[model samples]
Target: MNFATRPNFEAISSAPVMQRARGTARIGTKQRDGKTCIDTLFQEGCGKIRLPRTHSSALEAVFINTAGGITGGDHLRWGADIAPEGRLVITTQACERSYRSTGDTAHVEADINVGADAHLDWLPQETILFEASKLDRRLTIRLDEGATLTAIEAVLLGRDAMGEEARDAQFSDTWRIFRGDRLIHAEATRLTGDGSERDGLSLLRGCRAFASILHVAPSADRAEQLLDRVRALHPAAGLIAASANGERLVIRAMARTGLALRKLLVPTLIELTGAGSLPRLWHL
Candidate 1:
């Protein structure tokens, strides 16, 4: 064949398309015969919710991501609702992993509602960001004035044992909480590029692991009492701090490694959540 007439194979070749994951999981609880029971549950795609038998009065739920890890173009959503006088505790089966992204950004959203006199504990495990990973996550909670909520979100830049560091990664996290149409707490965090090298007074200060805890009670006095108890724990002197404003209590902690961060979180969470201990999945 003539060179000019021959087909250009290289020019016709195109990059293979990548598959993206999407999932949604929702659970709702109600008070039945003086016990919290599942009222509604929905799960699709890779998102899953498993109910593990617990001796406590509260209903327990564990979320799972069958996709293993999140990457570019992946989307996940979670939601929960608690009926009056019901109690619920939600946790993850394992730490969430955000792998490197080539294009776009991974997205995750969680919405929760608590009825009057209800209680909810949102305690997901740490989210590890791999090098070059990009993620956007948001959490929204709406509860009645008489309800209570205790939530914790933690993050790790990379695996300490593996000596991995998340360089050139991007992470954006936001939280909005409301009590009966009144906004009580709001937080937004954005980190781009190298997080480990950040040293600004308001930044991570060279820490690779960090966590935020929020507790909302029915009254200011209850929140103050919880804050006092947390203070009694003497959380990692310089690495942790707790404060209370009205009916909301906030705690922030940071450390050099995930293990260190957990050391500070475990006891503090136990006190704030009134759970006596963490979920079984947390130990695993």
Candidate 2:
């Protein structure tokens, strides 16, 4: 065989680049002295949990990704079970970053089970996608009858402060939440690439940071007050909007800057669910 015309041996067997990380974490709830606690927990690989911290009456579970960030061919799985009457809050230690991928897309999946009368707050931090990155993430919640569930998902196109540009990226994020056999809320957000950011379709309207919050419970108390507060804080006419149908509340917000988008998130969450102050790691 001709040496130069033959297939390159080194390129065909690139062993190191194909290695990927996998993480799994599971948390189960229980009762102790009339208070809810994390009864059973399992963590491996990059998935980790910060021992529940005393937070008034509820327990806070802080999840950490030891791999630091995700890239092509990486997989992350997280799950939690809320016992009857258990109240728990979950948050990430810091924003998760998705890097440019040369091969397969990165994946993140979360499954939450809430028992009757149980309350769960799924508040993971933002996911930032770098230029040419590919990420597909999904979160599913199965709530028993009378269960209270709240969740927030945020995404940033690129690192705005660093003057970086996400000229090309692929993102598909989905949320499916159910109560018993009924599906109360279903949302899917997709960005095939970064071409639409500068367009004039009115969708996103050149915004780099976007967020969505879903609350399903017996009551959406102070929601009107939360709307008023959102309007007061964000005088910008259409940056934020909220709607409610009995116990289900949905809020969507976008901003040209991350600071502004967050300004709308914190206060809205505090006033809407009245879930007490933001998670401590959120401030740090």
Candidate 3:
């Protein structure tokens, strides 16, 4: 279909998440006969859901999910597709809190596709780990040459509001970034079912909150400029940040508490994106 002749869904103001929610985005190129596609779904099972989409560029869509809390057997699955020259940005309304596991572990999966000359940003808010809760998360990204993607995944051990700490919780996360059919980056972190301690400097450094920011830019020099600022603002405890080879930067910030980390990361995100603030739903 012609760019101007494709069906456009009405701009949804609110995303309802009962037990199941699913979304999709597709785009067609103006030339070269390229195609792009992205789809995401959330299954409540035993939790509340909140997914919202706002604003669109020539070939872009923004998504945010707020899954209040989950017990056991609750799951969320999100996927995306980007055609040649297409772009997308995805976010979450708030932290995903997994309470103490009452049954099985809550699961999350993210699948993405990037067409030639396309771009995508998968920026979800932090995930909070509650005592005794178990979670399994996986992320996979596929991109073609001239395609770009930036993603951020943050995790907070527990809620500080109730004097909760992540010391007693179990969590696991996995991430993979691909350029066309080649894997560019692979990372995994797991803490559970073992007698291993999650404290000390080797891991969280006794901090309850931690965040990771990832950026893939066209220019390595530009990415460095942004990474420099984050390093300057990082705290004294080694800052926990790093930037390596062409066009990729990762920042890790740890704080004594969740709120403290929030104060630091929020401004950093705004600076990196060159925006005053993220979408309103991001702060909710």
Candidate 4:
């Protein structure tokens, strides 16, 4: 058969390559009428971000992933910049879902910048991982000397109410923060295993929900108070701990259900901060 007349073997060999989704979002603030205003926004591909109408003085941003969920080979990136003396809170429109993977791992990265005297709350919602999902995510933040950062992240191994369990999974998440080029926090959590493994149980004592809250430019008294509160409250049925390392305060919580974890985290943070205020979109 003539090469031209027949099927192009080389082209056919590559014709079925999976086309993964890619997205990027950028948000920035500016001074408007002597107040911090979100004046710059960008969205590309499947990622979109917008400022919601909020009664509070602080700027509120909500990120939307139009593709609905992430799977293997997908990539998403987000960046936010807060002007000097500005206050901003960032969150997702809903929980991010990671589906089962059949190929390469999904990737996500976030970059945040807070100017001098600025305050930022990086409070994105939880991420849910289904069985066999593969993912890697990283967050980097740069804060000016006087800036303050409050960030929270959570992960769920599957929906307990849905009767779904994630046993076969691979995930890694890392965070790095710097204040004026001086590193304040650098940490990573990695897990990988088959459908059944005793070692996985040791990772969390078989807990399905895990979360971490970190405050930079630290709060020792509040951290200690909250730690005592959590320990006093949940003497059993879950795990909660807190520690301070120099200028960073870290709190970690794990539970049998994702809701249980959130219940423990939200109230403690609010009680510590003296603000019942959370991301406007948060439910329970």
Off by over 4 Å in 4: 1-15, 194-202, 218-237, 271-276
Put down candidate 3 lDDT per residue, 102-213, tens digits, no spaces: 5577777777777787777666777888888888889888878877666778788777878877575777789898876777778888877343445655766577778777
Backbone clashes in each candidate structure, one number apiece?
Answer: 0, 0, 9, 0
Evaluate all candidate structures by whole-model CA lDDT and list the values in order. Answer: 0.90, 0.82, 0.65, 0.82
Candidate number of the best lDDT: 1
- Cα deviation of 234 in candidate 4 (Å)? 6.1
Candidate 4: RMSD over Cα atoms? 3.1
Ranking by TM-score: 1, 2, 4, 3
lDDT of 4 by residue, 164-280 (tens): 768777889999999888887899987785543313565677778899888775344654655566456544655777776666778888888888888878865554331237876
Off by over 4 Å in 2: 1-16, 219-238
Work out the TM-score per prediction.
Answer: 0.93, 0.89, 0.74, 0.88
Local accuracy of candidate 2 as per-residue lDDT tens digits, 226-251: 44555565446647877776677778
lDDT of 4 at 219: 48
Superior candidate under TM-score, 1 versus 4: 1
Q: After superposition, how far is residue 74 of candidate 1 from its true place, in Å?
A: 0.2
lDDT of 1 at 100: 94
